[model samples]
Target: MDRLSNLPNHILSDILSFVPFKEAAKTSTLSKHWHHQWQSTRNLDFNHLYFANRDSNGDVQLQPQIFIDFVQQFIANNNSPIMDKLSLTFSQPGDFQETVEKCITFSVDRKVKHLKLDFSDPTWDENDLDGLAHPMFDLPQSFYNHQVLESVTLFSCKFDVFGFKNFGLLKSISLGWIELKVSTVKALLANCACLESLSVKSCWDMDSLSVCGKDLKLSSLVVEKCHFLDPSFEIEAPNLNYMKYCGTVVLFTVNGTSLEEADLDFGPEFECDESLGDSLYQSLNGICPTRALTVCTYMLQVIPMGEEPTGMEPRLNVTHLTLRTAMHNYEQGGIRFFLNSCPRLETLTIDIDRSRRICNEYRPPFEDKFEDLWRSSAIIFRCITQTLRKVEIKGFKGTPNEVYVMLYLVNHARVMEKLTVITSSEESNNRGPETFRSIAEQVYGFRKGSENLAIEIV
Candidate 1:
């Protein structure tokens, strides 16, 4: 008995929607009733790389024409009147420009709510010199006239902001590897009246950016690795709740009172300067109201230099704090600064970022010993004694610094409830079971402040 085949057509179509279109198409062979169900799927995701055949050397042999033909056939056969999402990822648009235009037109005509087009060449390294020379696909004029688009993601595509129209319904947009002028970005934001989220990464031809609008509904913004972007970044979105920035230290004037979370990674220590320290201070002060904060090793190194000579009082309202570092001795001052500042912090997370170990060589030599740094500190953080409940150490290797810090937290956080140590994949592979058992025994032997504290090693 084929009970699944006996199900209602709409139910079968809904079920098929959960499977990839390629796999869903295979269900046609199951029964005559299932033959047309796939055609009614609301979401269409086609990746040309997935269709490409591999050669003897395992190199991808792109079949652009074959992929084009398959997509054309699918669109022709599909009977769905409306689409929830349409994602097309392919390269070499010069080989089939018309087909690509037609696909965009089809999605717009079907009133797709979500559209993602990634034209990044899979064979090229985007960071390489030659890769920067790769041409970008120009979006068709029809792409600008959509009235139902709610979300859009574009990668390695070139298009003018002047072509934009009727984006009243658009809510989210993500752009990567695109050359956009600051004015062009401003114009795009002006057009997206209802936009709630925007992400820009690796964009070029922009030295400065300002995201300011009184009625702007944007709630989240992400900017990363725009090498040309200078230090003058200004944001004034009162509705913004989340922001993630990764790049060189920037002079930021963030005025979002609603900001709740921020992840800041100011790249290598080589980029840091005394003036940049003030900029970092200003940036951190602007987002002081953030309830949850995440910062990298670069920020840790710069914070001490940025602090006032008289020393500012604990001002951050952060309840949850995450530090990404190499746990080097130079970072001790920064770590202490954060512990003192985040008075209300309830959850603490330390992520060992191995890539930041290179920063040690560039940083000025510190006379403080790693083991003695914490043990010598007499300052009592209010969070450790009263508020902190959980602590997590990721990329743990059971090193002396890690063990000392773990013991310090275990012995100090009187109200703490749990401590979790997640061993790094590299450490787990290199160390034997006996080594782990020894580490566990050491953790268990620590004199905990809270008798009910639960400890876990994974």
Candidate 2:
């Protein structure tokens, strides 16, 4: 008389997909029919969070060995010949690394398509004084030889991938907070001919890294927060569609046939070789046909000042352009040339500094009370903003300089349909309602080209 005993096995398996592996196995207590049904489940999703809250006294360590044993025994008794995915994230120093190696071997034996291993402790921050714990598990050589692995993600592990011979179907790979030799990364990428997405974040200890192959089919690449000793790279991805680099710019060469979006962040006191900007400008030359572009204020500062973009043409087809500036520097105003470069931009967004940037609080603020605020050389060609239909200003404080910026956009963007003004919580708390009223008065009286233009402030 079980409520779900009559459901077909396919329907039960579909329902089990919504629950974690351990929870799904609990159905065995419902009736004798379910005793062996969970064994045939195709996914081995063992997450520590599923059983983590039951910990005694909220200890940072994993909840208990019962949950661990349940998952291990379940996988040990698995009968499925082919698993769709095998994701295990038990980020504590519980089992030996050999146990994880066996689990991966088990997945490979069953022809698992997607595999994820997150052994890194979630609470272990590298910046903490005594943060080292749960040593990075070393991946077995056989883990890299599995041709059925279409996607693989490894966290907090050291991979000696230099010996890998084949990554036949691997389309995506993400490694975070891991350690690896420079030669190992090079060999791994050289073997992954079909790699489409690559993400490497917060990894350390490298002098130089190079990834280059004429037949490489990478489409999306992200390199974030990897503070290397001598950060350098040489990447040639001819088919990359999306790329985001959020760290110190390395000396690298990345070229692609076509790119749809590119986000570059060089804030947070990150820097690169003097030649980085120049080389990046050349790499961008390959993807000048990009539709969406985002750059932080630090990179914007560097490109205008140092990078020799003398002969480079502007990316006119960019439909969306986002600029990240420091909260305080939003008023000092130096991004006019960057805007003009994107001629066909349909949306213009101004964001606060990407990460926690050390703001210079000692300098006195500047106030400019001008009717015609924008005086940059780029403003002479106000006709370039014909396609700019929407404008959003985030972290807007009612500083006099910010008022000037608002006035410029209100004056220039003749056909703009909507303009949104969003203030940071701190600004809303500190500044009274009069500050907003003052800015609203100017916008109310500003002569907009479209009579239907709507300006909303928050």
All candidates' TM-scores? Answer: 0.89, 0.74
The count of residue-pair clashes in candidate 1 stands at: 0
Name the weakest run of 10 consecutive residues (lDDT summed) in model 2.
361-370
lDDT of 1 by residue, 1-458 (tens): 87887888788778887888788878888767777677778889888986789899998899988889988988877767888989999887788899999999999889999999988776655344224765789999899878889999998898876555577788999988777678877998888889899998777667687899989999999988765546677888889999998876777677754899999988633655556666777788866689999998877776666544212354788999999988877677678778888878899999985657435344432456777755654756888999999999897776677777888898888999999888766644478545754675588888888977999888
Candidate 2 lDDT score at position 37: 79
Q: Which residue runs does candidate 1 get wrong by more than 4 Å?
A: 1-5, 20-39, 53-59, 123-131, 268-275, 305-314, 376-379, 425-429, 432-441
What is candidate 2's TM-score against the reference?
0.74
Candidate 1 lDDT at 334 equals: 75
**How well does candidate 1 score on lDDT at residue 139?**
93
User: For model 2, how does the per-residue alpha-carbon lDDT over 192-281 read when each residue is reduced to its tens digit?
Assistant: 767888888767675565666667788888877775677666666677778887766555555544678888776544443335456556
Top-lDDT candidate index: 1
